[model samples]
Target chain A: TQLLEQSPQFLSIQEGENLTVYCNSSSVFSSLQWYRQEPGEGPVLLVTVVTGGEVKKLKRLTFQFGDARKDSSLHITAAQTGDTGLYLCAGERAGGFKTIFGAGTRLFVKA
Target chain B: SAVISQKPSRDICQRGTSLTIQCQVDSQVTMMFWYRQQPGQSLTLIATANQGSEATYESGFVIDKFPISRPNLTFSTLTVSNMSPEDSSIYLCSVHGGQGNTGELFFGEGSRLTVL
Candidate 1:
């Protein structure tokens, strides 16, 4: 079974602070995706990284895929109150449609 | 991107009862997925529903406890049978975005069930 382990299960930070969350796995994936879910809503896709060592940026967020495709990271610069939500990392196998998700990182950014 | 809608956005059910959640998508999709999520947690895929075929459940999930029906390309239903307190969770319906296997999913608002 493939599992993605996420670090810092919970985070509380003041506005304008920078934070980073990590997701690691032993199994290699064909692609990795990051999602943000707010209260009472399903997760929304933030970005998808398909290549090893690939990095993608969305406004104040930066996502990185590991060189071995076994891990990923999400970094938020100057996080605002709007950034508070649950962040999840999902991995897709090379030849399958199945997607495995991490435990998720709950971030709370206070204004 | 496809717009998805779920019925019974929130419900309170008694233990031992059953609830069937419905999912409707604006566009026809080849595959539909069902997921369960505990509060403040990540999603766990329950099964994959395909039109004109039986649903494929994950390792820990069984068809008896969660029966799924995909009568067509744009609709599906998931029934949680003999529910218990542990069955209280948010159920989400989702479909792949665009064409091919892009690894991107668009999800519905989700049906939140609370079992007493």
Candidate 2:
């Protein structure tokens, strides 16, 4: 079974602080996606990185895929309270349309 | 990405009773998936609902415990049979992974179930 492990399962920071979360896996993937989910809501797509060593930015958020396609990272700049949510990293496997998700890093940005 | 609308946005069911959640897509989707996220846990794929075939369940998930129906394209249903308190969780439906992509799952608002 393929698994993606996310670190810093929980995080709390003050407004304006910057933070980074990571997702690592031993298996290779064709694509990787980042999602942010609020309480009682399904995850919303943040960004998708396809190429190895690729980077994609969405406003204040930046996503990077590992050169080997076995890892990824997400960085948030000027983090605000509105950025508080569960950040999930998912990998799309080869020939498999299913998206496997990481355990998620819960972010709580205080005002 | 596809827009998926799931029904029974929130439900409070009694133990031993069952709840059936519905998911509908705006267009014919090439893929449909069901996922469950227990409290504080990651999203876990419960099954893959195809347009014409029986749903394919992931490991640790069985048809009897979580029966699913996909009568045609753009529609699917998942039934939590003989529910229990531990079965309470958020259920989400997704489809149309991505454009010329291997994976991209657009999700619904999610059905929140609370079994008491």
Best by lDDT: 1
Give the Å shift of residue A11 in candidate 2.
0.4
Q: lDDT at A40 for candidate 1?
A: 88
| Model 2 CA deviation exceeding 4 Å by range | none
DockQ of 1: 0.83
lDDT per residue for candidate 2 within B9-46, as digits (tens), equals 99999999989999999888756899999988889999
lDDT of 1 by residue, B44-82 (tens): 999999999999999899999999999999999999999
Write candidate 2's Cα lDDT for A36-81 as tens digits. 9999788988888989999988899989999999999999999999
Q: Interface-residue RMSD per candidate? A: 0.8, 1.1
Q: What is each candidate's fraction of native interface contacts (fnat)?
A: 0.79, 0.79
